[model samples]
Target: MTSTDSTRSRWIRLLILAVVAVALAHALDGVAWRSARLLSVNDKDWGRLLRSMGYLPTWGVIALGFWLQQRDHPQRSRYAWALLLGPALSGGVAEVLKLLIRRLRPNPDVFEYAFRPFADGPLSNRGMGMPSSHTLVAFAGAAVLAQLYPRARWLWYTLAAGCAATRVLAMGHFLSDTVVAAVLGVAVSTLYWLRWVEPLPAP
Candidate 1:
């Protein structure tokens, strides 16, 4: 099978695994809470930087970076737009989940929370708290870079993970929330790149 096909299948399997992970984490929410408390830190500079990660202006910067790089490497222009789309694709899924799941999120002021899957109604902000949107976006961006820059794959993962970790610190997002979202984000983005962004195999 082609690389795209292989990657697509891999993400599908990852999705299944994500579900299992989410379930397990949800079952052990107390542990997730404890981990969050332990991992959290108080650093305004780091918190502010991480908060900007999922913001619109940040994505514009990301797009501009792509534009600059693509100018010199026109060959990459074909699929490079995928970088900008990366967060969008994964973010869209996260939003839908937020509306459906309506998971209760921990207050930024309060450093405690739990996973409330299927505990929320459509459009409810409560369930949206389970799979962190910030973490998902981070992973989505990382997934694209990981594919494009194979050599710097570890760096991309680090950035993605670090960004996700910030959510636990900034907002009382449980490790479970960030962890599950991180996995799902990468899985979704991998599938998107394979299905839409990547060029099809030459016939």
Candidate 2:
């Protein structure tokens, strides 16, 4: 297939995998709940580790990496916007969904806390759950890094997975919430990388 055809095919397959994942998350609710409970272990050390992944630090690293990577190329600035906007786009979308859905998070103190969907929860809680922004940021970075450093693709994803796990284990989000965020993170970042940031890797 031509490059265009190949890219389109990859997009379709990736989306299919995302959809399948979301469906499975719902279909296997019991397993997801159990897994979430098991993973929800509060640890100050773990929280500190995940803090490096918070919005500011995460994007800070992206900016620093972009700066360092572009130091050699003449058109390095050309990629600056894409690098900064990757997380913005991903978090922006996730934020909107969280508000629109108004899904209350699993109690950060109680893994077994009942999920409150669209209960118009506290204003402070609005846009706080459903799809996880942290996971989105992690996967967004992974998606871009996977394209930029193909050799370390798995490493990036592994980091993203670990980061996502912390979000759950720290009792910050539900399993389904992170799963949805992961899918969106991959989809949005891949789309950005392919259309504006970089060409898709050959299959």
Candidate 3:
């Protein structure tokens, strides 16, 4: 296929995935929320820990550590740059969407479609659900790192998945929130990697 055709095809696939994700979110919100509630009753602590893995400080430290360790390596700069920038961009985008969309967190009192955009002002912390930021950050980091370190792609993606699961397990977001965020995170990081980091040398 021509480059233009390939790009169009990719966009079409993404559009289809978005449609499917929305449908799944609507159909499975109750089931997903209930399952999470059940599993998290006994595993809330574990879920919190996994969620922390995606926090800025947590992954920032990891990326910085890799950079420090690979100072003499050929792709150290690229790894460092991609790891830091990818997650930052992903999380930033998620945060903005959370504010703009302002979907309510999954709760017994609220259904999956609840929204309260700017209800408490732009800086409002309430109802800032949908597109779990934790998942986005985790997956963005995973996508970039996996690309840079292909051998450990499974490990990276597994950790990212754990991060995504934690959002549901904690009742912090609906299933759709994490699913969409996972896709967005990977898309953002992959695009960034392809446009900028892919040309860099790798060890």
How high is each candidate's TM-score?
0.74, 0.79, 0.85
Worst 10 residues of 1 by lDDT: 113-122
Q: Candidate 2: lDDT of 80?
A: 55
In terms of lDDT, model 3 sits at 0.81
| Candidate with maximal TM-score | 3
Candidate 3, residues 141-167: lDDT per residue as tens digits?
A: 898888978999999888888887777
**On residues 1-203, what C-alpha lDDT tens digit does candidate 1 reach at each position?**
99999978976887788888777866766654555553434466776676566554566578677778667666565455667777887788788877666667775445454345453444556434767888888888888778877789899788777777777655547667788888877877787887886774311
Query: Model 3 Cα RMSD, Å?
Result: 2.6
Candidate 2 wrong stretches, greater than 4 Å = 38-47, 107-127, 199-203
**Model 2 Cα lDDT, one tens digit per residue, 1-203:** 89999988987897788889887865654454556553434356665565455364666667677778776764554355555677678988888887776666776444453544554463344536778888888788777777777899999888787777777665577777888998988888777876875642322
Q: By TM-score, is 1 or 2 better?
A: 2
For model 2, the run of ten residues with the poorest summed lDDT? 108-117
Sorting all predicted structures by lDDT, with the top scorer first, yields: 3, 1, 2
Using alpha carbons, what is the TM-score of model 2?
Answer: 0.79
C-alpha RMSD by candidate, in order: 4.5, 3.9, 2.6
Report how far residue 86 has shifted in candidate 3, in Å: 0.9
**Distance from true location, Cα of 154 in model 1, Å:** 1.4
Model 2, residue pairs in steric clash:
none
